[model samples]
Target: MRVRNVRLIDGVSAQAVQDAVLECGDDGRITYAGPAARAPEPRPGVRTIDGQGGTLLPGLFDCHTHLGVPSDRSLVEAALLTDPVLGVLQTTERMKRTLDAGVTSARDLGGLPAGFRDAVAAGLVPGPRLQTSVGVLSHTGGHADGTLPGGKSLDLDYCEIADDVPGVRKAARRMLRAGADLVKICTSGGISSAHDDPDDQDLLDEEIAAVVDEARRHRGRPVAAHAQGRAGVLAAIRGGVRSVEHGFGIDDEGCDLLGERGAFLVPTLSTVFQPLDPRKTTPWRYQKKLRWNERAKENIAAAIARGVDIAAGTDAGISPHGGNLSELSYLVELGMSPMAAIRAATSASARLLGVEDTLGTLRAGYAADLVLCAGDPLRDIGLLSAPEQIVLVAQQGVVRKLTLPERSGSCQT
Candidate 1:
């Protein structure tokens, strides 16, 4: 397949290459991505996509997502009532929506069974490439704990309730044994949970360390900590987590620690900015979200200013899944150039997932995962959030979605 007459964002450069051509081989790797003048001639019978002077860039990555879980539903309701098979089907559909939104890859912090990763890899379904944590580790009454007031534990499929050091270690190992690509732990409270406030810290420091240690022992898999409070953020960093998810309460000191420790921050700006309706869940939940709404924005901006790597994540289950690209606009609002915001969702996220060499860039030899937008996102980052502006979506050289019916062409030998 060949894509021509496009402005290309290589996922690493600060500027776009005008009048570029991208050629993809059948092996699902890019053969060439360069200026049209230097591009090789199209092979016989090549499927050509005329971008019509649109923008072509690396397919985006959402560093944090929960595939099946709906943001509008209460976490407890979504966790407890859904049938296992139906849940998988629902997740499958959500994945397709995510792919249609132009995200080629994602890292699921929790709420997705790891088998789906294999399913997508085997081409049993159409979705973004997924690296799943399988389940989240939390202490009793922690954010992931869905214990009802009636004394019944939700026992959610994607949450493991483990307390103390040994229990956390065991849970981490269990997830690793179950094919988790990374370990996710709740180090702080969250907005959606009924029992804990966002300012409340959950797991013990030793417990956090144990989970991280176990993940390292398992082929050096990275650990993502669900940290939202100042104490929680610092503890996660001190415990050696690879990335801090929803770091809403990180202060200057925590930012310094993150920089020194070389940890990435997934701000989940969409979740932070999402409006809270007291009628949707509970009043306390709404209050919790309101409390950190502005503070998270400021703290994350500080982290960005500290030069700590910021990877784009929507916290999708807490927001809408297909709206993943909306996070880029938030990042731009928080002081990143449009190009840098794109990098956070592209190359930066690829590096975090340890797939930098194969994906996340429009370059020769890289996986042919690409998105064609109707306009230059640098001038208006909001273009990415508009589904109508996403002209085409290709993952691993397979065109999944294309809106430009008039521009698609087939060239003869």
Candidate 2:
């Protein structure tokens, strides 16, 4: 299949090439990318598409997501305890929504089991190409543990709670044994956990080191630390965690450490401005807690200045799925150039997740996962949020969603 006359944002910079052509094969690799005039003649019976000179980019990626779980407390608890069938169904629907929004790939930070991952890989569901971390590992009463007050018992099957270095090691091995592709550790308290303070560190330095070491044993797949405060961010960096999840109160020293260590920072900017409803299960306490410590703007600026690789992540279950592109806009507002923001969500994000060799860019021999928009995202990042502006979404060279019809064209081999 050949796509012609499209504005190309090749996942590197904001500069869009006018009158570009992209060719993809059934194996999903991009076969060509260059000026339309120089494109090879299409073979007989080859599918042809005219992009109308719209913006064509490598598909967007969300570095952090929770599949089949709501941010609401009761629903999360119920889902964890319920049968796997419902969870799979919920994941399928959420994945479709994510694809509809032009996100071709996502990393499931938490809340998905190995079965769900297998189902998605087997083509049983319509969704993003997923890299999943089975439930998170946390200390008792820590951020990922899901412990509540009033003696209410939250299911523990999804999360492994550890209190020491040995415990952390054991838990990491358990998750890997259960088919985890990556490990999630709560180094700090978080907004949703009912009993912990978001500003406080939860895991000890040794415990964090143990988790990182275990992740390394699995060929360096990387560890995602749910860190909020300065101390937590520093601890995770020092302990060799690959990425810091929230980094709400990251300071200059923390930023320096992360930069020196080459750790990526995933600032889920959508959380800072998420619409809150006090009547929900989390209530005003969680909302107020988030509002007080939301330092995404300041921390992001610091990280950017310090040369820390910034990746786009939305914490989708908390903010809302399918609006992941809003993170790019927020990154631009926080001082990243529009091109830098786009790269962070695409190439940079895939690199941080250790999938760069196969995904992220739009070069020949790379996956044909791509998106076509109506305007130049380099000059206007806001074009990402306007759903009506997205014209087409393709994953693995297959047209998943198309808002425009194919153009008329014919060419010989």
Candidate 3:
């Protein structure tokens, strides 16, 4: 397929061509991506789509998400009541929204339903290219300790409780054997969990190291740690985890350590507040996210200043799944240029997931994942979140959505 008469963003440094052309083969790899004047002639019978002078960008990626949680309910409620039938149906519908929002790739940090990744890979579902972490390993009484209110303990589809070095290692291996593409370790507690403080570090150093070491043995899988506090962030880096999730408490020293360790930081900016109505959000949960609010922003700025790699994530499930691009706006608000914000959501995230060479750019031989957006994202990053603004989408050389309609719900802040 050929796309011409467009502005192209190649996902390198976010420098855009005001007008360009792109060509992709049936195998879903781009044949060329550059200026339209020097474009190669399309073979007869190869369908070519007119971009209508729209902006073509590398499809966005959400680097951290939990697909199992229902958008309309609290995490606790979803955990207690969600069943398999409901889980499958919800994932199907929820992921469509995610795809329509211009995201072609998502990394599930935890609680993605079993077999969902395979279904997406096989084209049974309309969704992003998913790399899933089956569940998170939590310490006893920690973030994902399997206990609900009233002291009742039961594991959800997304969490597994483990303790100490041996237990963490065993849990990592268990997830690896359970068809996990990546392993998630809760080195610190989080906002939605009822029994733990987000600032409290949970996993021991040995346990984190064990999980990282064991997880990487499966042909080099990446490990993401839920690290909120300074101590946990430090420990996760020291343990050699590839990325730190929800790094809300990282300071200048921690930023230096992250740069030194060559670890990526996924800051889910939406966690401090979901854009939806307050009545729709869970009680006390939003407050947990708001904890250390000022310091968190400062820390993020510090990290960026220190040249720590920043990737965009929404902590979707806890926030809203389809609003993944909103994180880019938040990044922009935090002093990143619109181009840098887009890179954080695209190429940087792809690199963090170890798919940079294949999925993140519009370069030749790269996956044909492109979003034809209506407005100039470089001028207004908020345009990216609007489904109405997304004129077309191409993932793996297949057009999944086009001729966009007015979005059902509001897409902007």
Candidate 4:
């Protein structure tokens, strides 16, 4: 299929082409993408379509999401009570909402199993191209442990309790064996979890290193650390993890260390301004968020200024699934330029997932995942939040949503 008459944001750079043509092969890979006049010739009888002067962009990627499985107990009970069958129906539905929201690719931090990713890959599910961490590893009373202070532990599907280097290593291996694309380790306490200080260091340096080493050994799936506080951020960086998630307490020293180590940071700003349920938030979590919100943004601004790489992550399951794209606007409000925020959501995020070579850009040899918006995102980044503004969404060359009328025409070559 040849798509013409659109301004293309290739995802490689900030510039958009006024006259562009994108050709997708039967194998769902982009064959040619360039200016209309510079496009390669299409085969005979190949169908061509006018994009109606829309803005074509590489489909956005959401780096951190739970895919609607609910990390907390209240959300889990609600899901079970509301659905008659396994959460499969609800899970797929939420994922489709993500795709419908113009996100074609996403990484699931937890709250999903290996079967889900396989289903999406095998065409058994209608959702984004997904990479998942089957479960999260945390210390016994750490962020994801689901244990109240000095109390019995609650069994949860999304978390595995691991206290030491060996325990964490075992948990990491289990997730890898379960087909996790990356390993997730809780290096510190978090806001959403029960009975733990968000600023307290949870994992030892050796334990962090163990997870990273174990994951990197098996196909080099980089370990991601959930660190919202100072000591944890420093440990993650020093331990050589690929990216730090949340990073709500990263400081100047931490920022310099991140740049020096070439590690990336995925900051979920949406959670700060709009938490899972502001009204239901515990005083502890509320105070924690309030304390770190401004500091996190300041660290983010510092990260941006210091050229420390940053990616877009919404902590989606905490918010709404389809609301992923709203994160780009938050990044912009936090001091990123509109184009910079878009890149962070797209190509830059693909880099975080280590798929930038093929998935992120709209160029030859890349996956045919693209979104065509009615307006140029470069001019108005907030337009992405409006479903009406996104005229079409294509995942791997398959059109998922198309509000634009199909225009049948011969190649205008």
Q: What lDDT does model 3 reach?
A: 0.82
Q: Where is model 4 poorest over a 10-residue stretch in terms of lDDT?
A: 71-80
Question: How many times do residue backbones clash in model 4?
Answer: 0
- Superposed model 3: Cα runs more than 4 Å off: 275-286, 404-413
Residue lDDT tens for model 4, 1-413: 77888999888776889889998998889999989899888756666767888889899988899885653446536444656355777788888888888989899898788787889889998788899988888887788876554575556666888888788888888888888888988888887777677688988999998998999899888888999989999999999998899988888898889889888899888787675455776677677777777888887777777667888888887766787888888888877888788888889999888899888899999999999888777778888988678778988888888887664447574
Listed per candidate, the RMSD to the true structure in angstroms reads: 1.7, 2.3, 4.8, 2.2
Predicted structure 2, TM vs. truth:
0.93
Clashing pairs in 1: none
Better of 1 and 4 by lDDT: 1
Using Cα atoms with residue i matched to residue i, what is each candidate's TM-score against the true structure? Answer: 0.96, 0.93, 0.94, 0.94
lDDT, candidate 1, at 130: 95
Give the alpha carbon lDDT tens digit for every residue of 30-118 in model 3. 99899887777775566677777788999889988877676667665676667868877987888898999898999988888558888
Model 1 Cα shift for residue 146 (angstroms): 0.9
Whole-model lDDT, candidate 4? 0.83
* Cα shift from native, residue 60, model 4 (Å): 1.1
List runs of model 4 lying over 4 Å from the truth.
70-73, 76-84, 148-153, 275-278
Tens-place lDDT per residue, model 2, 276-387, is 6666645646665556544656776777777778888999888787777988888888788888988999999999878898788888888999998887888799998776
Q: Point out where model 2 deviates above 4 Å.
A: 71-84, 281-287, 290-294, 407-409
Ranking by lDDT: 1, 4, 3, 2
